[model samples]
Target: MANQLGIYGEQQAAQYFLSRGGIILGRNVRYNCGEIDLIVQMGGEVVFVEVKTRSSWDFGAAESVTPRKFTRMKRAAAAWLEGQPYRSVRFDVWVYVVDKGAVEHYEGIDGGAS
Candidate 1:
């Protein structure tokens, strides 16, 4: 059930991004070590986004991405970029609070500068 909710949240995030003029490059893009939840093109940058969603903030908010997860995401982003057509890239995080139906888009949350 939680997994389902998370997937639904990712879908919502993808849609929100699209509505905000983000072009969808890929979804659930996977390499050997990890998977990127969403790949989008915004402005001139290829954006790799990780989506986190939660029904409540009892434990913590959805922004809680661990170091291990970031490492995996970085590896996945590297794998993705090695075969991509873009020269510039950025990593982003989209946190969706399900109970509030709100989406917070955090650009350049990882992988250095925007």
Candidate 2:
């Protein structure tokens, strides 16, 4: 049930971005380091989005990410970029509130400043 809700939030996050003139590049993009929930292209930057969904907002989005997780995201992004041309990238976080069925997007939360 938890996994299903996570996937549902991912789908919601993807659609949310797509509705706002973003192009979906990848979903559940995985590498040895970790997984990126969604990859999107908006304007000139490649955006890596991390989705965190909850049945309730007892713990907020900002409270959920740990330093270790951020490190993994950076490592995974590096792996994903291997062999590809240099592209501007940034990290985004999506907080999905299941009860409301809405997503709160945080653009460029941390890292990937190029």
- Which regions of candidate 2 are displaced past 4 Å? 111-114
Q: Residue 8: error of model 1 in Å? A: 0.9
The estimated TM-scores of all candidates read: 0.87, 0.88
Give the distance in Å from residue 43's predicted Cα in candidate 1 to where it truly belongs: 1.9
Give the whole-model CA lDDT for all candidates, comma-separated: 0.80, 0.81
Q: Residue by residue across 1-114, what tens digits does model 1's lDDT show?
A: 999988998899889889989999899988888889999998899988888888865545433676667788889988888866798888888878787877677777754222
lDDT by residue (tens digit), candidate 2, 3-114: 9988998889888988999998889988878888888888888888888999887757645667677778878888888886748998888889888776677788774222
The prediction achieving the highest lDDT against the true structure is: 2
Clashes of 2: 0
